[model samples]
Target: MAPGTAERIARLIAPLRVKPGSRVDLARDFDPRYKGPLKKKDSAELLAVGVTLLAEYQQRLAAQDTYGVLLCLQALDAGGKDGTIRHVMSGVNPQGVKVSSFKVPSAEELGHDYLWRYAARLPARGDIAIFNRSHYEEVLVVRVHAEVLDRQRLPGDVRTADIWERRYREINAWERYLTDNGFRVVKVFLNLSKEEQRTRFMKRIDLPERNWKFSAADVRERRHWDEYQIAFSEMLSATSTKWAPWYVVPADRKWFARICTAAVLAHTLTGIDPQYPTVSDKARKDLLTARRELEAEAPKGAAADPYAARHRSAGG
Candidate 1:
């Protein structure tokens, strides 16, 4: 990382973040087509740099094994969440990252509290976990269509008119608890314009390769777009806490959205600043002894090891 790169990234994303306690009216407050001063041509190079930074930080994070990161992504259909994940995380090692996509609740999941399934899938120490449409779905989707709550099996007393407000507070507190326990929660909402969403949907239908991505149900959900926007606004306002604030990434342009997403994640890991663990004195001594023993046994000629000459030529 270059000097002040982290600070630059922080500045780049400051405008996209939802400040804690701020009221959000998604349509009025954020422009889904906003790409700042960067043009489409700049995305590839910016994203490459972001990927390199992510890879470096991820290695240190894994080696340190002292903290975890959870990325919560929320988006409407055709909002580019999948593509954002694919491009932003392309350079990371698969072993250290887990992506969990949450759909409608399964019978088993509905049997437990709404957060149970999400909590169970949290990242282990030194790992990153991404939730595609996460626990916030409880507030967004269920709030949009209140009838979905009928299936949750909640106690009658708990299903009062103030249920949404209660859930918001509970979620904020839960995120605070995670932050205290060495886990950082990152939230992003892909803010896509209604026009852009329709355009993407048309492409999904017109292109054979993308047909599988389209669903009639997705189109059906379009009818409730206004309601969903309201739910999303409320969710952002209520849960964008200091511990886990939300970034509203403009999703009208896929390339711009990807780079912005990358910046947000890179900024996060940069702040955490995880480092490779330092060995203790006893461990260092054992390492020296092991090195000596290995050196004493390694007497093979160039002919014995096929790559010995190559290693020597490369100064290995």
Candidate 2:
């Protein structure tokens, strides 16, 4: 049976409250109506809306100075998190955008609370903060590698089961607090099939430079794929809420993944406009005069670079 467009859109907005230590199916509820190989035209069409929404969101961030957008992106290695961020957010102004790739926490970071670095990196008023992998890792990685807790030195009171649930409750409450304090959260779990991941892993092995990216951990993690999926599904169901929704993006096709992600981001951000700052009437008059003065000095008859040459230089 065919799912209607309305039903598909509803899925996009639906909140997921995935539980801690459990997997969730945040994969796309893709419909044929919106599924197609992403060609240049399709990408451009998606970008048009993305650019506009980003501009609007930028304005709101600047004006409200209180509201922010916290976009959390998580996926297996090579799930295209970096690429998606690059392509989908290509049009966003660099000044208003901030990307944080949370790798292994530093020795100093280990000294403070788990969220210390995270709290420091939270988007300022009128900013968009992107977390490549977020505090969720404290749950995922810590659970997968129990030794990681040795570094955290958590209070003795936090038993394994109690700690996991506490962290889940803490995250939910934290997100709710942020939303109430003027922030919109978007969590995306890139859904890459095991077969697709195997293909990517093979590519890394076959290519010379890519060999460096392959690790024992990759092989190790594959062993736990089922557990991770179960964990992810539970996480989505427990954490997915109306205030901050989760988008399950199918990632078999990298290009399509970028398009769909950009679409969702644009959809969410369009409600708030991020406009270029306005100048006063007097400032505008002065700026216009300065522009006219500069234009007057333009050399009229000079030979310009050939279109082909310009195009070549610009394109490549």
Q: Which predicted model would earn the best TM-score?
A: 1
TM-score for each predicted model, relative to the true structure: 0.94, 0.75
Tell me the lDDT of candidate 1: 0.92
User: Against the unseen true structure, what C-alpha lDDT does each candidate score?
Assistant: 0.92, 0.71
How far in Å is the alpha carbon of 249 misplaced in model 1?
Answer: 0.4
How well is each residue in 1-316 modelled by candidate 2, as lDDT tens digits?
Answer: 1235334433443432233444444443322123444475566665565555566566666666656888899888778898888887776777878999998889999999888888888887688889998878877777767788888888777756677677777888888989898787878777788888899999999999989989978888899887776666666666767676677777777766676676566555654434456689999999989877765665786324345556887899
Among these predictions, the greatest lDDT belongs to 1
Pairs with steric clashes in candidate 1: none
Instruction: Kindly list the per-residue Cα lDDT of model 1 for residues 266-293, writing each as its tens digit.
Output: 9889889999988999999999898667
